[model samples]
Target: MTMHNMKLKLTKVVAIVLLIVSHSVTANTGQPNILWLVIEDMSPLLPMYGDSTISTPNISQLANEGVVYNNAFSTSGVCAPSRAALATGLYPNSFGANNMRTSSNTAETGLPKYEAVPPVNTKMLSQLMREAGYYTTNNYKTDYQFKAPKTAWDENGIFAHWRNKPSNKPFFSIFNFTTTHESGLFEPYGIRKLEQRHYFSSDEKKIALLPNDHRIKTNEETTPVHIDKATRFPVPPYLPDTPTVQNDLWKVYNNLAETDKQIGAIVSALKNDGLLENTIIVFYSDHGGPMPRQKRLIYDSGLKVPLIIRFPKGYKAGTIDERLVSFVDFAPTTLAMAGISIPEYMHGHSFLDTSNERQYIYAAADRFDGFTDTIRAIRDNCYKYIRNYRPNEPYYLPVAYREKIPSMRELLRLQKDDALNKAQGQWFRKEKDDHELFNVCNDPHELSNLAYIENYKTKREEMGDALELWLADIKDDPLMKERQLIDKLWNGKTSQPTTEAPKIAVQNGKVTITSETKGAFISYRMKNDETSPHWQIYQKELPIKQGILEAIAHRPGYIESAPISLAIDAD
Candidate 1:
């Protein structure tokens, strides 16, 4: 027999043994691999969602073989806070992660870097999967409004892929495409920041996605614009239907086509690895569109995202799920898919496991970059209620990052000249109503304010009451000063708290781990296991296994310590 054949058989045997250890592991099929295809700053603009502007063939293919979720909503209108909720299965507002971003290179906010301080023993979704022996990875976009725990993923970088893991181990991997990001609408048009936003230490990934590289078979930059400029695009009521606006819409569709090509490449990779039928593929966006009244506001245009989940062996294929799924539900749902127990601390319930359904999805908007505005929204299937705490503040805040877009510049110019009509001038209002209500089913654009409408008084009051009850339950204080919140998170200090390295003790034929830092989660990995490169959260005293053990300690907002290794003698 060939050496390669012998090695493959041994690897499969080990993988089967590992799966047997986890109680919730799939019986005959082995554990299903989970893959997340995340795109930035996009909304439901595909054929699956009733738009024919441009066809996303790859996304369409996934939809045909998967379930389409029409009512999926994000916790926030933007990425960072929404990501925080996604990572922890909790509301971003519940943990002080409601802001768009925790820290920025611009330093316009004049506040030090901070991390969303969740309650004790809170672990990220990926970290939870690692505990269940799944090889976890992220192709590097983690704008969670906090630094990810060191134990989050086995590999997290531009090159991280499922192929790099042990042949037999089931994996949970994430790949983020920035082709359709808000930055795509920037002055330079398709290449300025180029996928690396939040400007983390990703200099090594600077050359990851090359512009117009033909070597990659599905290189998005090399493709022609799928939708022509002459094509009449659907214009939202709030934005003017001018040449500049039409051009921006053209770019958005073209960018999505490029994003589809990238998605196709990833699907091809999974097929090449022979894991397509054994993995569950999820395609979704970070938030809604990047246009005005879409990216930063709490309207449905900003909060709703497109979601398609393709299950292994075509489970629930070609089905449309109208359940009100939220970003907070993502973590729990993924964990439940892996047969892991969802923690009670999680604010979201397992959509796949539980029979009960969510009646409403809540979204919030706090400070954005340097601008501070307080807005909260609650949406059911048909109605949406928005409460603006600062009624005197303009509906529009001149966010520096957004002003970089050409169409935004045109809108501002038109507003200054008073050339904008009533619909186009909605965002430029001097002040907004304290409370607003909209029947989103009838007015998807959320332009018709029904807060004072006598006919819809009952619906408006019910939504308002729901919003108030949600805020109190989550203990969300949008009125809190950013500086004060920062101080509270850091234990009255202006700087972030550091987590002390974990101390390990070997006793009674078992290993125990502890950390001095408050709220620091301790996890470890066996150095001798080639398939288990990721750290597993320490649940209880683990019996000494046949290998050397290595462990690392980390907390969000603090630097992780070097791994501490300990040699173990076989019993």
Candidate 2:
């Protein structure tokens, strides 16, 4: 028979075998149930992604039987933005969630001055699915741009899920499992642990199976909701190969394996409940694994995630659809699958509709590294373009850096050394790249930069224009109205904003600053100070200080403002 028919038959056979072997995943084909199993701080480390060192049996099994996108990426590099894009099918900046974290739009936080839009609008993918007559539920997690409003789900909680439903109703449920979050408190090794241990040999019988950062404290371990305390994470390659690193990586493998085990159990339970056959099960991660630079960044290791969609009946499983997929596309894709109309506001196209799927998947990143302001990247099937708006800013900002990850500190030290080496220098260097481009086909790791080369100028400009157009379409006029910076109040470790221009206000001897548009940061520095750098926002009880408070508000695509002057009476 034809190759296409043969592939379809093979898929059917596998589905049949799974039904027989596991005695689960059986149902009618006409109205299939939809299930989303989402993991946190994970990249595609499964065997399907070619990482032999770790055991991701369930995910690998899913990939083997489902369509896996080789070039999937998040629209934004950071968490809130990435999630915002994923849920809304729009770019993060367009949704006014351009920063790493955000305050929910409440009262003054909403509309007019600040877009009335909640960090995560209640009217999103899940809501759309529900409106399509599907019962929607969340597995208790909305760690996205903002809180998941009540209207977003019919039911949700840490222990309970909506998939625990009656078979008669077509259901759509999202399960966010937080077992791979890399946390500093989980470090069993204390501050200088990696420095103390060189290597930890494999001992499968060990108590923890993986020692983890050995830095994880019990109190911190209890918080399963946050990315930091979720699970024992794997250490990445950019760090030292110390015992700490080895143990950390091993723990990540162990934890991932356990997560997979749990996933199998959940699927098995679903089948037992007779939800398998008619169910379309999807497995993926929010961004990437919590291994060093993998999370909250635009690197492949950060943006690329494991994805598997399984349909025993109509989906034609074991078929690989390689068209580019971005997280932003998930919302529209879900609606399309549910037979719902695509919203005009969606910036992403559903991949399920060959006519609509993305020809070029877009990805970008703004400030996320605690106190750094960086705007970089674009990607399609072949090339990637990155423009660092703030090239002179510190590349290794302390805020986003993970202390428990062995690779980060190692890279930091290497950056200090004058000596140079090959295949290194990718981590912790002060000198920032102003612009970068790479042919991903030739360089999957994205180790090389082609942005400056004369030959690639045309391609870069094309991508740059495309990015601009997409961004312009998504800007939230209401949200962009309040132009103030998003920064930690007391910490010197506040991230940089996008631009310098916004209407300014200085009042009550205290500079009561507001933005012409809501920006990521509002930094202040003395006008005549020798250091041109800004002081991150640090104010609580304020009666303006005697020093001149020179301020600026910034966000992606927006320019920085001239300092708004503020003066306080001498104490």
Best by lDDT: 1
TM-scores of all candidate predictions against the true structure: 0.87, 0.67
Candidate 1 ranges with C-alpha deviation above 4 Å: 1-29, 105-107, 196-223, 506-511, 523-551, 557-571
lDDT values for all models? 0.81, 0.58
Candidate 2 C-alpha lDDT tens digits along 56-131: 6677767776677766787665566777777777777654466554543333234211221332222568767765
- Badly placed stretches (over 4 Å) of model 2 are 1-30, 104-122, 163-167, 184-186, 189-243, 355-357, 417-423, 476-571
- Root-mean-square deviation of each candidate, in angstroms? 8.5, 16.7
Scanning candidate 1 in windows of ten residues, the lowest lDDT window is 198-207
- How well does model 1 score by local distance difference test? 0.81
